[model samples]
Target: MGAFTRYATAGALVLASLPVAASARAASATAAPAVTGAARADVTVPEAWGTLIAAGRAGKRGIAFGDCPESEMLPESLRCGTFSVPVDYAHPFGPRIELAVSRRAATGDAAERQGALVYDPGGPGAASITFPLVGEWSAWRKTARAYDLVGYAPRGVAPSPALSCRRPEEAAGTPTDAPQQPSYAYKRERIVLARAYTDGCVRAAGPALRHYSSLDGARDLDVLRAALGEPRLTFMGTDQGAYVGALYATLFPSHVRRMVFDSPLDPDARRVGYRAGLARSRALESRFGDFLSWVARHDDVYGLGTTADAVRGHYDRLRAEVSRNPAGGTVGTAQLQAAFLNAAFYDDYWAMRASALAAYAQGDPEPLVTQASPRPYTAKGDENADAVRTAVECNDGVWPADWRVWDRDHTRAARQAPFAAWAGAWANLPCASWPRPRQDPLDVRTGRGALPPVLVLAAERDGVTPYAGAVELRRRLYGAVLVTERDAGSHGIGGADNACVNTHLETYLLTGRVPARDAECAPHREPNALALNRAVPRGTGPQHILRGDPAPAGS
Candidate 1:
């Protein structure tokens, strides 16, 4: 499909919209050691770059000592250190890329400690300072409590030499998924921003942008392992983070131990763009249908219509209303698209949407405004987001390299899913306009070779990384087991009951055992009593709107 405008309409629950082309792409802490007096696992560098990389590739490990540079250290459980890795792995020592490393020493008790397990938070762009502190995520606080938790920023990311924009606040505003159509003028603005962002990074980051992909990032992780003094690498990845974990396993199979990949990214879909990018719209349409049913039952809450169809009609009219006029000239397509993108992620905003509907009906946009400009993280330069997003994605693989190819694909996808068409394309406008040519993206493929079993979890209908990706990944890795969350469909394992998922997850981390075979856990729909509009299940009722937990799912 060629790029077009994103129009949110009530169709057969799913419709395609055109997408613009050009845009391209795109931690934990440890605790004290349990055994202090025991001999430290002896790890020594051969003092030769070839020896080090070779041994690492061969799965013969090395010991990690204190961090590289004191200045870069994070004042957390894990002390910060830098290791010398080749700026380009092919040219070790020619120029060096600093691998920012952090480590929480073993609780000083060797017997109780299961060794170091490094966890990676996704973003290809989230700093990895408190990775070990993610015990709460794994349901293995006791088990992980013993191992050293470690994390490091990817190259050109924070905690490393970090790429730059003029300011950090550039990251503000809800990052509404840019739809894939040209009708939205924001499409053109986004392209300009992406180019400007890349220019700034090039000026500031120098040559670092060339080696910031998962290929090199995976290499950096190996270097982290060598410095930390571990026998093997144990890791956990979520969303796009899973891709990193999968690649690590592929590149350093012997060193991989007990990898737990949550919210699996479908690298296949990533290779063939339409599947992964459009899954959100498909998932949202299904979930929105559910929301409309709820809205119909709570007719008093939103007087749009009594039946689900009526509720949908209300939305259809609302979309057209906003598309043509917006709320009393206060809201526009960009603002409305942003709100819709954010709202579709969770249930916390039904009332907000209801309120917006009520207000828009009366020509007000405050409800929509509140959502359009959400503050999910500390804001950095909007330029930083634009740069970081493009730098990573554009470098990972060649996007269309041909806008015409992108146009055909997007036009096709939009006809099937109008809600996200333009917005999705806009999110990636940077790739289309990227200044650099991309290498073929890494496959992150793992053939049927038995690996030390790992735990892979996914919500069946996850909006970002579809559950099928988990299944595909499991088949790729020799012994990996995948557990499906039937009803949960967002990040953090769909934020479900947590009991069943946790029980299995903790067992794997604590005992190194896998479920008998690939399995599926029952779906945990947000109970009506616990329904909060957000993807996370943290706060219920109005409190839900106030607290954010389990961060939003990413593409």
Candidate 2:
């Protein structure tokens, strides 16, 4: 089908599914009164959604505790199951898909049990089936003990019907040796690759491509909520997953008991496709400056440089070298960019990343190669994660149809913000030629007092899902109390061992008492290289914890 036809079909399906009065209310944002807790009963769910919830409950089955290939590393206490959801909620009786789910029962007595705390760890495509296992070592430990911890691999992730577009080797195309100011030829080549990748996804998934959006994921969450026999949902999501939680609460306002969003996506900025990427690039540039300065201060240990510019100069040389010759025959410019881009996510990674760069400069590429290795969640050559991320992001909002628009915007961004501008642009380039039509961005703005207060945690300088997004989300969601970790720069905040952030989060989760006003907490102490070098084992440190990798024994 043509793009326009697909757009109309998808739009029509969604509109047809909504109750006429709710549709009208949605169209006129002002028509709905401020729905406070006392008036929450007035909120009504769409008939289509109610039907799906009913169907889900009827089909709900108990989770069976068993061994699986991926579960060996997971805690044995965790149990796995599959929850059936329609591939296309627009057509509820249509082809169905199963979401892989894992659950850890509350450790506390029956009276202490609150409800299921369904969690999603950030990536639109990140595998979350192991989250319950990981939560045991995370800041969620207290919350996990009091509530049943639930994790699910959203549709199109492994153990679910995954979307695969290319093989691992083919997906990692050769690195470009283009200058920071890329040539027009490089831009054109990127567009070609984007189109080819989009075409591959179209050929692989066909009509189902349009269904893999955050909107659909939100609907799936409601279904999962019903299957668990919960009257309301208690959710925690980070990064892009935060966007999913926001969408869910918007669609099912009355069903939300409590929710938390860490490092949230700006729903408003995300609708304007390029704006989100630009914001991310600028944040990365600012955070990169911080990383450079930190390394400069630790020059005695890293010996890279003693000034920020000097450190950047050394980095540029490394990039140039890697562009020409892939480190360890695999860590090329692409892998190098991916590796350093992570530093922007968490400050804890600064020391390790600096150490890796220093080692690479001295002709030992092993550490750099290992640092750039594919993350456990995206280990399928990252193809599935990349594909799902592309699908959700492209389908979530309207991307510029004309490639020239993207070329112009990114070229300008690259000039001002050289850190990851082009890399971010190319990572999302597939959207320029995505096979599916873009849907109108969901209107998440609710009437004042529409829902219970939400807790938003953000770091002052978080690059991935910048802090500004948390502010935007707080503004959009009425009564959302934002807890800022002043001067910190971590993507996921609650579980990084910040006593201040964790206390507020734990307090809210245990008792629904939000701070009378928004609050700020001091940033965690910076990593100490000397102390770290002497104390930390070879590979285990804050990097693994921040990355959500399996913890070391006794962690």
Candidate 2's C-alpha runs over 4 A off are: 1-47, 50-72, 172-179, 269-272, 373-381, 530-555
Whole-model lDDT per candidate: 0.56, 0.71
Tens digit of lDDT per residue, candidate 2, span 83-125? 6776665554445676778788888888889989988775777
TM-score of each: 0.73, 0.86
lDDT of 1: 0.56
Would you give me the overall lDDT of model 2? 0.71
Best by lDDT: 2
Model 1 lDDT, residue 63, Cα: 39
Best by the TM-score measure: 2
